[model samples]
Each structure stands twice: as structure tokens, then as C-alpha cells.
Target: MAVESYKKIETYKASDVKTKVVDTDVLIIGGGMSGCGAAYEAAYWAKAANKKVVLVEKAAIERSGAVAHGLSAINCYLGLSGRSQFTNNKPITLEEFARYVTLDMMGVSREDLVVDYARNVDDSVHLFEKWGLPIWKDENGKYVREGRWQIMINGESYKPIVAEAAKKAIGEENIYERVFITHLLLDKDDKNKVAGAVGFSVRDPIFYVFKAKAVIIATGGATGLFRPKSTGEGMGRIWYAVFNTGSGYSMAIEAGAHTTQMEHRFIPTRFKDGYGPVGAWFLLFKSRATNAYGKDYTENVAAIEKYKPYANASPVPTPLRNHQMIEEIVQGRGPIYMRTEEALQKLSAGDPKNAKKLLEDAWEDFLDMTIDQALLWAATNTEPDKAPS
Candidate 1:
């Protein structure tokens, strides 16, 4: 008798769950990098065309998504010309950039997309600056280059900057924060087209259903699909944003969209134990990687052929570098090290103004993107001297 009464009460509570309805011309599912971009454009265009726009985010847009911690550098910038002197000044054409990208993916990358990204990346970055993103610029009044096609930036508060811009484009009321979208709604007559989506508030039990003419899903990349090197209690250790749990992929799959490139995993060879940012060492400081015998294995490796024409590109393709590092390890030349002394000495002895600017920029990079790791470095008096695990 008591069990039956409890079951009836549970059913009653379930039936009492709240459901909220929203209608808009355009509904965006995720609020990460891609989602924010889509929402910003959608809202802008919708306003121009006199249409309603809605943005649904799983968390607060201010500190939500992958770039919440901030970014140290902007990759794929056209910085070959106009900028003069911290050191090397070389021109990088789109073709050279495309070639390097192709080599990085081992020829599996979408070259067309690469070219398109290269062309538009700078404009988008500049727009971010216009919206209050503090990009580091040199005394010459040009954006400071961290490496070829890369520029240093203080992007710690980038999320809020972009989110505020989005809100301004679309009314603040149109944007929904802390809404975890569960599934997309399909058109009744034509199942192929997405009608809208349904979600629930992260903080409350209120269920949300959005009805719209179009939907966009941009929840960033997937992580935690496969186990990392760390096992047991630390198995969750991973480099990518942990929040991106293949939600975008799953949503697309349910919508009958074909997903590809599952085999291509970007397994980065990073620092052991902590898995700190590796790009900072080489890209910002111009550190070189040497094997056990202090031999520069990167130049002699077969992978070097991939970036043949642009062999000396300031920052080479990540995958190509990782591949070379792994080869050295497998060949019994196990230990590898980032030779930073030469770069450090140069930085210490170089033009005071340029050196000060470089260190400040690099320090800000560590503080924003990887504060915890930066703290670890400070506590232990360590640098990127050891080989990547």
C-alpha cells in the first residue's frame, strides 16, 4: 500500500513539470565558437531582414564554451607583409599556407575550407578587435606576429566581448543562457528540414521548446570519446574542452546528416603529468626540439618533406611536428627536449623594448589561457625544458 502511494506521488510530480515555448525565425542550438559566430551573423541578418533570432546556450555566454579561458594567439593570419622587425620578416602567401595545412593533416584536410578560412580569418579577428578584443600591436602600429601567419593577442575576456556584441545585434531578451538543448524539431510535412529544437534550463526543471524556420548546431568539437593516456582516477585528463562531449555530432546524426572524418584524431604530444600548452614554447619563444643526442631531428625527418617549400616556416604544422617527435621516441632516441636557451639568451640580450613586449605578451598568454599551468611553473621554477610525453 505504501509503495503504491509513493509511485502515484512520483507520477504526479512528473506530470507537473513546466514547459516553456518560444518562437523565432532562426534558432541556434549551441553557443560555442561556431555557434556564437552563427548567432552573431544570424541576428545581424535577421535584424536587417526584419526577422526574429534566438540563441540558446548551455551555459552563460560570458564564460561559456571552449574559449572561456582565452586564447594566446590567433592562428592563420595574413601577417607576412606590413609588419616589420622583432626578428625575421618573411612573406607568406595563401598557397604556402595552404601547402603547410595540407601537409599537417597528412593530405586528409579539406583544402578548399583551409583556403576559405585563411581568407576570412583576419577580417573576423579584426572585427573582434573592433568589438573590444585587445590585440597586441607593436610600436610600428601593426599587429605583433608570434610566428608566420600567427599573431599574439590578449584574449582572456574574448568570450564576453563576442557575447556582448551578439546580444547587441540581437535583443538581450532573444538570447537564452543556461539552456541545454536536447534535440532538434523536424518539420511535420518534410522531415528533412529542421523546424526548431527543445531543451531544458540547466539551473531549473523548466523544459523549453523553440519553434523556428531554421536551426544551427555549432557545439564545438568532441572530447572524452576515447580514453587519454592517463588512466584510473585520472582517466578524464584530456587536452580539448571537456564540455564538448560530441553533442554536435550526435545532434547531426539524429537529424540524418552524414558525419565524416571520425578516424582523424588530433592527438597532440604534450607535456607529461600536466599536459600544458606546448605551442607556447616553439611558436612564441622560437624554441627548437632536439633528440637525446641534441640532434635536431625535425629537419632530417621524412615529415619535413611535407612542408618542403616552406620548410623554415616560423610555426610548422602541429601534426607534422608531433609525428617527427614520435618517430624519434620510437627509434630508441626516447628523450626529446625543447632547446630554449638560445631563444631565451637572444630575448634577454635583444632590444629592450622588443624583449619587454615579447615577454609581457607571452606572460599574458600563460596567465589567461593556462593560469593553473602557469602557476605550476611559478611554484616549481620550471620551463619547457623536458621532452613532450
Candidate 2:
């Protein structure tokens, strides 16, 4: 695929999507690292065994799934040094890694065991190599060790690369992009084996029924449903996609299919506490995070006098104890989360004096950026009751 190929496939607003029914075998939902890995494995393996494969993704297989953006890593492997510093003679085996992970891991740890990650150690290296990544060892005959057994390579390829490859191996006619899987069509007779699936396009929400001997659901994960402290879609503009909102799980549940590791994999995403769609996107481009009180968060950090403000703001949002603010508003101390429309209107009707100051204050935070005069339009309005103590 060339750079021009993707530009040709416009991610037109879903409202513009045109969907139709299709057929396929094996549908795997979730197009993140695991999802793409599953697709690459299934498609290529089936191709190796001479089988037909169709992978359905809610979003363009790239930029939406976990692996779509820029993430070139496979930390699920074990180290022979095992100590993480490259102990040349101490080659770690699957059993050793598994025993360490499962045994010492107490409450909840995503760390892999030796046996589990063992096979993947070399297998993953091979997988990268297969994907055209030139992985190599260090001059000392160990994985190019840096901060630890953390081998750094030219591996910044996104998960979309695999989808790009699968799109080729599986043939364009066989692949359908932007198709959402809403339900698993169970084989009426067997009930256990899935014969096909049904879905619609978010663009139109029309019913798209697909039938096949074996159906796969590649619908990714549920994210963007809430604002995260980091890069969450709090308003559904999630890090993943809006379509990943429980559709796959809903389909599986409706079909009565049981899932394993649900208990373990049921961890909430990190960095979603203070995230909002408009705030998250704009902050990355220019502005920085702020407390509900409209305080400059970066300035607070810079005043700490302890650490050199690690640049402008802490690389990550600092979780502050804004109890007085939240309590005053939420518990009727100051303002409330359920601010009435009237209150918002009043906050917006601020005097020109403070309005310009607020926008200028925010503008002063980020380097080399400007907040349009229009952004301060809302500042003129009355704010929701301030968080009171």
C-alpha cells in the first residue's frame, strides 16, 4: 500500500457512510493490538491453510483500534537475563516467567508469566520480522538493552500496518471497512457455532446482515465513553472509537457466548479522570489542563519550587485534591454538576474586563499559541457556582 491509498479512503463523517449486507467467515471484534494480531493470525493462518477470511472493523482498521496509531512495542515477552539487565547466562524460560508472574502477583497485575509470555518472546520477534521490521540483537549478543531488557528498535510502526498487510493478503474485495458488528447470528441448529453476524453502519445505522460458515467479530474495545485524565473521549470522542461502546460484548452476550479472562481484563482504562473531548484535543494542540475553578494548572506546578516544573506542566496531569471546589458545587456548597442553563447564561455574560483576562491567562500557559478571541466568548457568561468548601 502507498501513502496515497489511505488518503483515497476518506473517513467521511459516519452520516455519509453507505452500508450493505455481506458474508464472511470468522468475525473477531476489537482491532487494537490484540484485535489486529488476531486478524493477522487468522487471515494469514487461514490463507496458509487455504481458507476464506473476512475481518469486520467498526472503524477504518487503522487510527481507531488499539494498535492503529503509533505503538511499536511487544512488552509481553520474558527476558533471559530475567533480572531485566541482560544476565547473559540466565536465559528465562516460559515456566520461569509464568511462575514469577502468577506466583508473586497478588491482587491485580497485567504482567505475564514465563510460560505464557515464553513462546511469545521469540514468536513476537519473528512476528515483527515478518511484518517487515528489521529487529536485531545488541553488539553484546543481547536484545539491544537500554533502560533494561527494553530493546529499542525501529519498531514504531502502528497496528494499522498489520491491517494494511491483511488488506492485501485477504484481498480488498474480501475486506469491508467501517462496518459495525452489532450482533452474532448464531447457527440456529448448532446454537453454539456462529454462522454469521449482523451489523449496521454508524454512518446510516441501517441493518447489515452477514452470513458465513464461520463469522469473526473484530469490534475493538469500549473507550471514549468517559473523560479520562489523559487521552480519553469523556464525551465519547475516545482514544479508540465511539463504536467500541459495548457493541461487541452486547453481541456476544446476546448470542450467549461466554468469555474468559473477563475478570482479569475488566480493568478500567488509565488517565480518564479529567478528560473531555474538546479539552483533550485542544490542549494537545495548544491549551493545558485547568481545574474547574479556571485556575491555571501549569502555573501551580511551576510555583512548586521543588522540581523544575519538568518543562511547563508535569508531563501528566497532576491529580489535585480539589475537595473544596467539588464539595461546594456538587453538595450545594458552591456550584453543582447539574448547573442549570440559566446559570451558564449568566456566567457567559461576564464583563469585558475579566473575559479578556481569562482568555489571556490561558493563552499565557502554552508556548507559541493563541486562543482565538471567539474562545473567550463563553467567558463573558456566568460560571456554574464555584466549587465551595
The candidate that wins on lDDT is 1
Count backbone overlaps in model 1: 0
Q: Kindly list the per-residue Cα lDDT of model 1 for residues 262-301, writing each as its tens digit.
A: 6667877765444556566677777777888888878765
| Candidate 2: tens digits of C-alpha lDDT, residues 1-389 | 65554435335665764556676565565555556666667876787777777766667665666544343234444555342335355555666555444433322334443355466566655565577763436565445432212343344354556666666766667666676676777788998888887777655546677778865555665655445433333354343444457677678878888875445433222222211122211221133234455443334433334433322232321222132233334433332222222232343466666545434432332111112211332454423223111
* Candidate 1, poorest ten consecutive residues by summed lDDT: 3-12
Best by TM-score: 1
Candidate 2, residue 98: how far the Cα is off, in Å: 1.6
* lDDT (0 to 1) per candidate: 0.74, 0.48
User: Which portions of model 1 miss their true places by more than 4 Å?
Assistant: 1-13, 79-91, 232-234, 260-264, 291-317, 327-336, 350-361, 383-389
Model 2 residue 261 CA deviation (Å) reads: 2.2
Listed in order, each prediction's TM-score against the native is 0.83, 0.55
Residue 12 of model 2: what lDDT? 61
